[model samples]
Target: MDYLSIANGRVLYILASIVIIVVIIQSVLFLRMSWKRGISIGISKTKLKETVKTSAFFAIVPSIPIVIALIAISPVLGLPFSWMRLSVIGSQSYEMIAAKIGASSMGIANLTDPGYTAQVFSNSMWVMSVGIIWGLVLSIFALKKYQNRMKIVQKKDSKWAEIMVNALFFGMLSVFFGEPIVSGGLSLLVLLSSAAIMLFITWIAKITGKQWIRDFALSVSMIAGMAFAILFSNLGAV
Candidate 1:
């Protein structure tokens, strides 16, 4: 069968649904265990319930963007694969970039480009999987050692270590925020607008003592940023 047909195939959807079901089962088990443990540790039932409520609320808010991203990618990669990838280890940005690289390597410009076949789709999936597999494997094997090394460095010079950690965070932030600015289009506007919304949300949360606002601040800012992007696109301002 051709790539487009495979993308929307029933078998793929069934497999993806099975993976999701497994994940759901695991999550339910973990939650049950954690709840029992919390009770054993003398946590009150009310407090435990509240904790679950807050977690569900916060998780739902952040997951909106992820769902949006999944929808955005579904057309190109097919619903089942895109859903599975995002639900598992793949971040939206990373998946998009990996798919582009995979397509380019196969002489296709992008995921949506013509002449893409089932083989091409398989190649793209392999590329995406292989690209991310190393980090997961390394973390499973070496993360504790890496963390221990950081702890040793911190013990040797706590102040210097703090500075180093902060620098690393800022450097990562710069890369994420700087790329859109360098691209100089709707992306730059979206970045700036999101930053502004986040700052405003933080300020209002602090002043108003609205804990819920603080909890949902990131989600609100991201939604606002997306709205601004749409408006700008409609206005041809970007």
Candidate 2:
């Protein structure tokens, strides 16, 4: 069996289309629910509408990397599976790592090996899907309780709650960036350039008093950082 033929088959495309439809339905339902809840809480319609617009903007903007990743990995994983995986989870690094590990386990040497088989493709798909199941399970079961606990903390001591939330945010950043930072060289340089781009955007937003532009800071910085990495790689600057 051809590896890519299986990965990008019509059956897989159909399945991916179904997932996309389900996601759209879910997004609409959640948006309606949130809008109603906001109205109930006396949030002005204008503010809520603005919030929706800003949210949509943010969603599309930050997805640049996911689109790039989908293209980048399509050669190894095929377009349909990569599209579906990124659309659902949006974890580019995790999916790539899972797929590579799966391929490695099959003794393929690497994802780009010419001798890849349908079995290797199947194994990679299974690994990518099953490895992320725990996060979904926790989201379904623990989210409500976690939300309630945070509310209680905030109600009791807002200052302490703020500190707790910031701590969580920074802790996540450290974990996410720790490995790449320690790897040094190109990864470290890209990270610094991205941070610099974000800081520059924040300064522009502050000095210009156009705070809305700050929302795109992450998107711009991420794309620019990727561009920088590509430039450095091509120029043999590492």
Candidate 3:
């Protein structure tokens, strides 16, 4: 039946298309919301919808790059090692993340098993969903408590953080799913592109006149670091 092979190919195409489409849509919405509101609206309905869409799209999009990178690396390291290497990078992810959060590092060990990728993916999906809801709830609470000026900053930070967390979880999910789609030089190209996107997001957020821009800066760095780690471990010269 070649079920494993067939299923893997299907997943590659499905996830790739969904991730690309969602990212494009989210980017357009982001530009539109920023242009229209100019950091004034506390929370526009249009912006809210865009944020939600971006959050949902980001929840899984980050995984696509890793999945594709692994697929690309599968030839060099075989199926499972490519996946294990990705997880190893994630093991130290929380350490750097904790440091950013002003907390002591929490050493997370790599599961490093082929079967573990699926479990990690499942866990990430659950966590991302929960975080999105929590972030939204917190944003509402902040908006009510803070003044209008603060609300604008708070809203943007909240949405940006929500998207970052979603991206983080999706990156981890890629480790769990363990599908490879790219290889050779193409793999490296994709990894660099992913990093460029993350960097661009950080740069844009920082340059904006908004006050809470710093909050998003660190979060973007954290998310970028996590994704880069996975990409490097899986794609680096392998």
* lDDT of candidate model 3 versus the reference: 0.50
Estimate the TM-score of every prediction.
0.67, 0.76, 0.28
Best by lDDT: 1
Q: What's the lDDT for residue 146 in model 3?
A: 55
Residue 103: error of model 3 in Å? 23
Q: Which one wins by lDDT: 1 or 3? A: 1
Best by TM-score: 2
For all candidates, the clash counts are 0, 0, 7
lDDT of 1 by residue, 1-238 (tens): 7686788899999998998899889889999999999999999997777666666765775687789999898888899999998997788789889988888899998677776778888888889889988887999899999999999999999999999989999998888777787788999998889999999999999999987677767777887898999999999996
lDDT measured at residue 163 in model 3 versus the true structure, 0 to 100: 80
Tell me the spans in candidate 1 whose CA falls farther than 4 Å from its real position: 24-69, 103-114, 154-163, 179-210, 221-238
Candidate 2 lDDT, 47-149, residue by residue in tens:
7876766667667756878899999999888888889889986497888889888989899888889868898898988888889789779999999999999
Residue pairs clashing, model 3: 70-180, 71-180, 71-181, 72-181, 72-182, 72-183, 117-176
Per-residue lDDT tens digits for candidate 3, residues 166-224, read: 88899996773343343435345444555576677767776785534433444455466
Q: Supply candidate 1's per-residue lDDT for 237.
A: 94
Give lDDT per model, in order: 0.86, 0.85, 0.50
TM-score-sorted candidate list, best first: 2, 1, 3
